[model samples]
Target: MVRARAAVAGARAAWIVSGPGARPTMLELEHEQLGGSARSDDARSTLELSRGIPLANVADGRRGVALARYESARAESASLARALTIEVRATLERVRVLERGRQVFDRLVALDAEVTAAARARVRDELITPLTARLVELDQLRVERRRATHAIALEEALVERIGWLGADAGAIVLASEAVEPESLTIAEDTIAARGREDAPAVLQARARIREREAAERLLAREQHGDAHVAIGAFLERRPSETATADDGGTRELGFRARVGVPLPWGTIDRMAVEQARSETGLAVQDERVVALAAATEARRAHRRLRLAWSQHTRDASRASQIDADLVRVREAYRDGRIGLDAYLAEKDRLTESRLEGLESELTYWEARAALERALGLSFEAIASGATR
Candidate 1:
């Protein structure tokens, strides 16, 4: 292929030193026949042929003839090497993807630890109740741990699905890279928007109305039933007789046939048309209603995005300014610069603000994904509203 590409159109070029050659070899056949009943005997036949139909070895007849023989052994070795190289490259890429997935799960594990520490500190300072608060914190910890474990399992399964392109888990276990997550938020609007296709189910109840209309139209068409046309033909069979059949001089053969399409008149088709209309109306009406509800959800996501942007900007500034302050927010609560309740409230508020920022970013992506669905486009499918 590379050599072909190097030659320009109509350009004189050197010929190949060698090309692929055919091989003539063995052929084999086998046949067997047998009777199921004991009364009959079985039969079998087989034929095998080997080293057949060899081409003329030109070297025998042409003395001192210059012929190029292929050094296929070397070429075959190189081809094998290239194939192995490609396989290794693919394996490396798969390994890298799996490694990234594992890293994500590792982060989740670290986040669980942080949640634990925060709960302990809060309890020690009497900022939260020991029994109820501790129990709540434990539940949250378990959930986070489970999430991390589930992520690990999912990544492992993904590797297996990709033909186990890397070494075993033990060989590729990542070193711990722990960082606790400070925020958690859900994108409900995004979820609802993505599931909008369920709106089609609303059309089912109105299908009967459409069916009735169709039946009425069909009935009307059927009223004009049994419609056909007839025509006579004059033939000169055995023309030597001259104007025989039509002229009554020879025997006449009359052929009659009828063909017509039956219409439904106004009965059946009308019912069907009505049914279809009803079904379509119901489907459309409910879908519009559902879509309006969905639009509200989309607007909510939009509102959240704006709120998150504002809060994120303000909190980021506050955090930056407070970086040099020695007084811990928790200490402030103990010292009454802030009440215990007030400090916890502030901490919660700040944590949520940060989480909202992150969720807003995620919501943007999710909203885009949802919009694609609402507009009936997948990621690869170009959206009418989308710019290039």
Candidate 2:
């Protein structure tokens, strides 16, 4: 099976996107502190700050802070551009990594196909030519042998879709005549390394987490207000509670007044900061754990492939021995070294041995394939790169 080839030379476009808008996160704390003063001044009109200036301007001030969070979201439009810049670039890197192996797979398919065809031709040239089916021969002698099997095909599975790659199925390659069935090899380390990183899914998840964090921090920051103390000298012409019987029955006095609170941040924003912190911790841990597991899986797959290769030579020889034994027994019996019952018994043994050897060979090949799949390396990338 083939994996999706990474585009290399004609690097279609960069996949990773990081840009200026990503800078906002850097200033999150500073903005959280300063943004309030700007909003308090600008939003006083909409927030009815003047109408409640005396008693409950507190609520109005909090509302002014809330508007800042909304503004933060508005500015986050920059992250989109940021994200695009990085995404396209990461994709191009991935493409380049894959293209190298694809070249090898292309040649592999051709060689394997040639050998397969040659095997078929050999049977036709040497075996089929001598076996002239004759009705008259059957009439002359009652020795009639029914062909037990039809096809001489050796490969258990058709080498269909040589470069067929699917989701990280990049490591496996088509078997060439020289590359023996079930053997695995790799060209690029980056493909495996990237696969180990599990970057795409991890990045996507991180994006959502970061967005939430920014928004959460905004939410928390709004809870508090600017740390300002009012130093106002209030000259009162009238007092609201009662009329002072000073001189004219109507009260008029000159008094200095100061009104202020430390800041609204503790009440309006700190809780949001705490929540964002917890969420960030969770996101980081999750990505770390997932990334580690993915890398371990890839590495394990790679190790298994290496082990499979170690056994390939021995398996091939064993399979060859079994084939030779089957051929020798079958010929001896057919040439009358044994009688009918003995011939039948020897033929049965040979068939079983041949079948077992084929199964063993197929098993080895399949194991090699599983190992390759783990490596996250693909031959198709090589071919595709060479094509471009």
Candidate 3:
């Protein structure tokens, strides 16, 4: 993103300094000193200054071509920025999901310890068989291993987030609560429409096509070449060689005017024009390809976002019910109404629900980010339900 912005700045500066309509006239100064000259009897010196103004730069339509190129650079920069934003958002969401998973696993590991201790006590009191106690211990070890895995995954995700957001992000605290799924009320047709005109990829391709078109026109105009007018004045001084000696030797002052008209018969000019025409045709084809791909991606993203949100909504509701069920199972196990195996099974169900919910939430957010990128819309705009 930083690099893209810097490129944009550089392009802007270049356009202002050297692009269309800048420094219309070229200026030059010349000076010469002669001593012991073959054609002159005395030493001589000359000074000349001239300005050549191009009269064909604007008339040839190269100015429009330069402007088109500048605009193309801007569009490319915008596309890069949008891609970066989408990537950053997806990475942040992934980190958040991993963190939540780690925390949930941590709590589960502690709960497993309590369950294992209780199972051992029950075995000592002869309330449960040794095999049951062994099973409980094995489940505790498994939970511990899963917790360790989550911890490692969380660390990796944090590092990834830091890579995207910079070192300072390492100190930033993420919210414990998960983000709710965004609503997908906008129609897929709207997204397809917007993507064709507003998506970064499509916009960039369109800009480049226009730039190439301008270049083609400019090249065609160049076949006639540019016209320039130059005017100069010069002063020359030398020792007088005439019969009569002058007060100040000899001096000559002269003015000159020149107009240049190219014959426009250069082979390079014809080749360049042909190349530009071929490139313009390629650019036109590229725009079509880009537009088609952009629209397809936009529709695909919209479909995925809708399905992910739906799945997340269902998972969220199921998770709430599982939470209530887990509370009852825990109470029943403590009250001796449920056996160790039954209690463990219920706990596993709750764990499955939590993990599945987390996965669904992550998927939903990822799809949302993808959709935002596809349509060239901001997160805020999507969240505000103004995707149209």
Candidate 4:
């Protein structure tokens, strides 16, 4: 309820102070009327009217403060929205990575099961030891277990992310897509950091704070205590007994004017002014530090992680290619009785490990790219669209 009221007040203030068709002046009006009659006397009556005028400069300064506050709120809201977007994207990417990992594990399990079956058949024909068949079965079981663990972890992560988005668990249906490599060479770290300072919510929020404080200082300077001017008319009717002999029921009309001004107290006003100045100064310094530090830290850390992930991914890809060739040769050799079943099984295990490693490397690469986008205060789609 408090938040709702604040939102309503902010909207009203924004409209009144900054919206189109806003007037510079404020209008106030007042009216009063009275009438009475006694049995032994003539009627008596009175009427009064008044208007109030607010100082234009003071009013404008106050409006300026309100405008600054409204802008700060908007900046904060935008920052939160951006942060949430990054979180959702990162979480979705993690889910996708784990999903792909699970697929690799499934394939591994299936292949292991096939190898185990072949080993059992070989044992029945006295072509392989029973122990070899047992080892193959154990490998298959391990791969199955790993797949189950990965699936559970991925589901939990996805659910958590969906919850953060304020959606129902049943409503979320994640679709997998091809993961693309990040282009780190296109933009330098210093350039990205500079952009982050300009775009990051923390920096924007700090800058907004400084603006609001400055506006407050201006408002305090413009204010000269409190003052108002009132213009009105007064009218009265008197009974015959109170009227002069030449006048019948004396009637009078008069103009009324009033001006109110409070004596300015230097102590309190000076303190307020000083406080505003101090806050603005502090915010300015803080803003500079926060913007530079946040941008540099995120940019550098993300760049390093991305580069490392890319290198690892490249090596894993090459290793997987080599393993694939080795697996093909080993299988052919075992079928021709040139290599033992154990050697073929080892080659198959190596191939599985290479595939798993590649998946892990790809996952790390994607995660690093996502982190970089978050650090730079941008989204993958935005980066892909050539936005720095």
Candidate 5:
């Protein structure tokens, strides 16, 4: 937002500079004093105001370069805004994913505690070896360790979110907010179109190209050179040659005007014109490079998101199946049909499967966010189908 505001301010300044004007290249006021050599001499004073005007720009193309800059700055401001929004959204989703993952770890730790208790009871009853009980305790401790690690990561993610939002941590509440349960799917053509039309990098590059072109035109106009004109009125009085003479030596008051126009000399700064042309060509190439990169990234992100969603769906199904298996295994272990070790192993597998599913979900969201950035679409807009 700060960057966006700065860009907006620049645009405003450019617009103001580009306003209609026959701009004065130079303005001067002069003062002069003249004195005669003898005591009877009279003194003369003069004042003048003069200005230089660029004939080439005065009539039509005045500040054309500034006008082009204004347009470029306007586009840049919008691009900065879009980029800022994408950053915020991506950060928000990262925090959300980390929050969800923390919850999963929380559940895992609780389940590990229950399993450890059951393992200790089986050991006390002589149904399980002490080594087996120790293994369960170790597993429980590892889960606790992992939960601590996850807590640290979650805190870091929340801190990052706070910095991005410029908000207090207390104001950020995510537990009550429901997770995005489904993936958003946008058409490939829509993504491509958005990349070309709205992507911040592409837009900025194209705007720069236009800016360079305008600069070239302004430079070409400038080659005609300014017309320098100085017009002034002066007064002069001189002492009489002899002290007793009736007539003064001299007295004159007159207006003087001087004008200078450059001859249509050889090309003025051919190198500068060529440099401007080269810069414009480079800007064009830059736009193409940016456009190609945006298009490629948009396609790649879209594909990754599609793959993530598919993986999430498969993992979700596998987790559900593991959950069913765990229920049956628990029942069998209670009835003595399966050993406690077997039940514990199945429960561990269920935990792994659940974690896998959660991770897949996170991957899907990450990919979705990447795609949104590449296409220069906000998550809110995508979710609401605003672009569609």
Candidate 6:
């Protein structure tokens, strides 16, 4: 009986081990298969997503390229504005110089008119010869003609300045001021340094070009043929046969994912990048050289002109003073019968010529100063204030 009980207990334990609850059901098997498929689908989707290009990088590069272009345009505009300012100031200064000279010529012409009238009266009264009167009239005419010609030149200069300032021919009236003496001491090294630091338009243009080229390189790097990824899902329904109990149908679901990359095959873009880089480098070196050479040439020329003008002005001023002193003595001698009217008239003419020369030299001096200002990219006011 004990052996029979042991065999029965062993059989019951075996049956319990292999019961329906212990075995996997059909629903559970289906769930396991679906879980495995879902895991595989997730992996495939992840791989596809990972293959996509970094579009943000490309967009950022493009923005950088645009910004570089804008910077180039802005620099060009600024350079143009500076050039215009220089032109305007130079022309205005020239107008002032010419006007001052014209005023001196006007005074000389008036004196000539008085002398010619006196000589004509003396001839009529039989006190002077007709030839002398004729000579005096001719001198008067010459002086008037010179003054008229100078006036025309002054008007033309004023018109030019007005046009540059964007004003109507008769609308703008520039303030009249006496021309002041410019500082005679300007260092060549200081001028060159200032030009390089703030006035070299070519250098600014070259830098802009370099920035643009660099931006282009960055854009090319980002846009080098990109990879793409795609994922899709679809559902389908199929009718079953013997659908009498209900509208029996089978459902199917499918998923797919794909990743692709462009073939690395193109030398044209690479060549373009190299070309841009080379051009940028060449511009940096060549533009700087050209600008520096031009600045040096202009500075030297301006310096020479200023020196010559200063020397001429000093000599003419001294001569004018001498002529003025001689004129007083000659007039007294003519009044006391110690000299003739012709000698007095001749002395007066010498004085007029000396004054004209002095005025001309002054004008030239101012013109030279203006040229130096343009070359150095600094005005007299700026220099006086110790501003760069």
Which candidate number has the best TM-score?
3
lDDT of 1 at 57: 37
Which pairs of residues have clashing backbones in candidate 3? none
Which segments of model 6 are wrong by more than 4 Å? 1-52, 165-186, 231-258, 301-309, 312-388
Ranking by TM-score: 3, 5, 6, 4, 2, 1
Superposed on all Cα atoms, the candidates' RMSDs to the truth, in angstroms, are 26.5, 20.3, 11.9, 10.6, 11.7, 16.4
Each candidate's TM vs. the true structure? 0.31, 0.37, 0.72, 0.66, 0.71, 0.67
For model 4, which pairs clash?
none
- What lDDT, from 0 to 1, does candidate 3 have? 0.72
State the displacement of the C-alpha of residue 266, model 5, in Å, after optimal TM-score superposition.
5.4
Candidate 6 structure quality by residue, lDDT tens digits, 46-150: 111123454336655666777777777777776666667676666776776677667767766766666667667777889879997787678668777878887
1 or 3, greater by lDDT? 3
lDDT of each: 0.41, 0.39, 0.72, 0.58, 0.68, 0.57
Error of 6 at 122 (Å): 2.7
Query: How much lDDT does candidate 1 score?
Result: 0.41
Give a tens-digit lDDT track for model 2, residues 200-296.
3344445555555665555554454433222222221222345454432222323233344444536435766777778878877777765666556
Ranking by lDDT: 3, 5, 4, 6, 1, 2
Tens digits of per-residue lDDT for model 4, 218-257:
7575555545555555454555665676665666777766
**Which residue runs of candidate 2 sit more than 4 Å off their true CA positions?**
1-269, 317-324, 339-388
Q: Please give the lDDT score for candidate 4.
A: 0.58
Indicate the residue-level lDDT of 320 in model 3: 64
TM-score between candidate 3 and the true structure? 0.72
lDDT of 1 at 103: 52
Residues 300-324, model 3: lDDT tens digits: 9889988887898888888767767
